[model samples]
Target: MVAGIQLRIGILTQREIPSESEGSEERAKVHVSINPFPSLIPSELSKMSTEKERETHVYLAKLAEQAERYEEMVESMKQVAKLDVELTVEERNLLSVGYKNVIGARRASWRIMSSIEQKEESKGNEHNVKLIKGYRQKVEDELSKICSDILTIIDKHLIPSSGSGEATVFYYKMKGDYFRYLAEFKTDQDRKEAAEQSLKGYEAASATANTELPSTHPIRLGLALNFSVFYYEIMNSPERACHLAKQAFDEAISELDTLSEESYKDSTLIMQLLRDNLTLWTSDLPEDGGEDNPKAEESSKSAEAQEH
Candidate 1:
């Protein structure tokens, strides 16, 4: 199972962003009467006014996202971004959805290749080991480029234009997420720098979310969810992770009545995720010491629930 969950951000009534294909009807419903893609005369897009062109690109981007054609989505959103106007929440989500899918595949491949390389080295297969390492490096380079590109957009465009609100919190959360991806494979000083930057981004997001957004707001809960995850996975601080998760879960529970119908589903889903992690982490915590040893209680628990 995937160890941690990612935030599913979208406009009201939008379902969680699907990993595979989402219906084009749902996307088209979001924006009607827009021109479709190349099959329907691509030249007409250029002939449209700049405003119309931007609208077309945004529509295309959303459609590409639903189709999981992320490269096409990125191309279309890049055109939208070039207009240099403040991106609406849906546009920001579309941009992130595109880049994340593109980069996520590379990150997954790099991890698998790294594991294979280690096994090849153990088997004294130098040729296979070298090839795996080389491929992993290439994947890492691509990941770095993708992460850098998005981070630049967040700092240069998104952050400046987003004053103080959920948008600002959302941008900072994205900044942290990309930095965490960078820290996953980087080494030495580079890894340290990436980790520090990731921490800064998450911390800024937490501060802003706490002040500006309600406890039951999907963006705020999502920030807490990811920030606690950073503590556990990146910082190796299960104690801090549990504390943060518990705090957020508790606070959100207190405000459960305040959750609007539009956000109720996303908010509750994230809250459930936070609760699940808390259960996992708390059970794994060391019994006799302050130090967190997540594996300490695993064997006993496994023995109790053994199935063979």
Candidate 2:
């Protein structure tokens, strides 16, 4: 319980609050009246006076007199209602820490009271580490096959008149091999070496397209989808990351015609990869990943349920 301490921002007492219905039950008693002076003005004085400026000046003066008292009443109300609050010592110390880590905060969110082993070490021992690696590998294997098929299709369809025909040939084996690597890839060096093999083809295509063509050329579309799949499928989703994969494949199809007719003939692998995981979505986010979906399970967080 707090004693009667007068904080600067403390809540107002009832005595300070005013009731307008009971105060001064009468009209204000002042009014001003005016009349023009008679027979005292020269006719020349009226000819030189600026009419609009004089009216504006007189209007401002009247407004200033009315506004002064209105400003005072507002200031009085602010003074009565404003407060300076006092937080508990714990709260004050926490405020000193400034910001909270917001990315993963939830009821399940917790701080490490003391640490020797990691938070998940008890669960993720050698056995579980191997399991996680296996799961991760399964994702990469599917993605590699998709990457390979796209490159093969690009080679078979080698577009004419775009001057990138040579690039299609050059990148053919490189891209196809990248597709195979999602399974055999072990470390950063292996991935880097494989990517370096394809870099020359990308650079050559960039140089060729820049000469007789503008940036909006259809070649960019093929490249963009290729990279999009690489970034999202290989990197983010893996085997389970095939969301919208077919749509991306289809959207990049017209550009495929710009390559050669044979470019897409052997593209069955790409089609197969795209169709692999069309059934899942964010609607299937894992329920047992240390949290419950409030929408999916409204009764999960009840205190009574936990006590049992």
Candidate 3:
């Protein structure tokens, strides 16, 4: 899937054999916290601002990393979109719908971002690009929901022995909020690739958990590790991305099944700690949103007008 996202057709859901009695629906009724984060932190937001400011750095780093991953994802999808025109009518239609928003949204979003980046020069109210922040936030929320749904299913794999009860529910929802946040990224082949790449990176970070460190909790490691893998798929890999994803999934799923109920422990509290730190800003971007954007738009429009 990583390589395919490299081509840009990311699959939102890969094939997974589900146990009929996994209790996936019940998991939804339960709630789990998510990592404390926003799509991105204001570059100027200082950690010294408050006692809670310290953890802000880590969250920003993670969110920045995720943003970069999505930028790469956009490139991969563009590649596939370029090829879509040659596809059959039905296939082209499907492909077009998948990229419909992202294709335009990225450009629109970039306009806002680039303008904001030049904040010193653009003092005009409409020229301030931050106004678009709300739309991006909406997109992020939608993505989080998608990720939450899938993770719920995947979380069943985290429970030790699948004992029919609330513990199973907690395991499923331990990081439920993550789904919506993760899903916020580009969700096609590109997303799959992104997830796969991220998974590998996290897995590499967690190598010591299983054997070398008996005190470490493998399930927790597995969850963090697996979340990154899902990012790999966003890179636009095809179905084959699953192979790269399988290792992490296996570790997580296996840990859920084999570990005895008595053996379960909060081996690593990192996930929970991070999960509670979500500090999203539903607030507006500064006024003066991207007025300077008109010049570029006008120039492009004139060029298109001439070409037409």
Candidate 4:
């Protein structure tokens, strides 16, 4: 999601940001000319005092988003989050964007390595299997750290400081998303723990959405989108996934007229996503069985074993 801000002029500044990897001295110069939002002028940022550090970090985070320097963006947002103040919707979006991009690549890599490792093991290629396992473990470790750190921010700072239900729902949804990320690669006890935490987080968000948000709200719709995904992907419950997605989509469709112009695009976009997932999953559903279906059970068991 882009930080929705408008600006008229560019600010030229040099920043020394650390590399994504630990112990790296790499830095990049941020050309504010590329900033999507020019509403905040350079002079204003320059004249801000120490008390305005939050704004400065927020501005830098936006710049990093424009630069595709997600690590810096994540770092800057972490500082903003640590401030223990309620986050604006724009700031929350930037925070999610930063961590999502930073962790997304690693998740993709881990999945690829998992696939390759299975092939190597099946062929009895011990050497290649060992190497793939090692690299995959490193990726898993990084994913674990990222998820844990973000969860800490959500549980300790964001949730408590959230003065509005909108903010509460957003924070809980984010918590669920990161925990589901952990369940993607974690195994055994770790997988079980992540899955349970994910469910609790999504459940909390859903409960809040039921009373605190309108059906057509983007945050509510987004929560439905991801919560259904958790059921389908992590829990191996296509039926539940489809049910959740369809219910959310239908409810939102019924309330389409209530959607605000500001969130019309976002809410509609998520509704489309929900409908798409429902279509795909419903087509794959079993004819006359529930979670106890033998095929579903076998598939879930096989996937569980693969994580080990």
Top of the candidates by lDDT: 4
Per-residue lDDT for 177 in model 1?
Answer: 85
lDDT-superior candidate, 1 or 2: 1
Q: Which of candidates 1 and 3 reaches a greater lDDT?
A: 1
lDDT of 1 by residue, 147-240 (tens): 9988988887778878658888888988888898898789999999999999999999988998999999888888788787777766777788
What TM-score goes with each of the models? Answer: 0.77, 0.27, 0.22, 0.79
Cα deviation in Å at residue 12, candidate 2? Answer: 99
Report the C-alpha lDDT of model 3 over 33-115, residue by residue, as the tens digit.
33234453644234324323323433443353356543334333333333312222222223223333333344455445544
TM-score of 1: 0.77
Q: Give Cα-based local distance difference scores for all models.
A: 0.77, 0.34, 0.34, 0.80
How many clashing pairs does model 1 include? 0
Model 4 C-alpha lDDT per residue in residues 1-308, reported as the tens digit of each score: 22223334534444445544545544453444454345766666554543398899999999999999999999999998988788887888899889888888898788788888989999999999999988998999999899998999999989998999988888898888899999978889989999999999999999999999999988888888889888888887878877888899899999999888988888887888787777667755777774522233312311110000
Which pairs clash in the backbone of model 1?
A: none
Which clashing pairs does model 4 show?
6-39, 7-38, 7-39, 8-38
lDDT of 3: 0.34
The predicted structure with the larger lDDT, 1 or 4, is: 4
lDDT of 1 at 191: 91
1-308: candidate 2 lDDT, tens digit per residue: 32233223222322122234546333333233222333435454353243334334334433533564323332222221121122222222121111111111211221121121233456557665565555555544544544444344344432221134433332332342343233224358766555554544444543553453332233333332343334232343322223344454464454554554443433433443334333322343344553322233222121100000
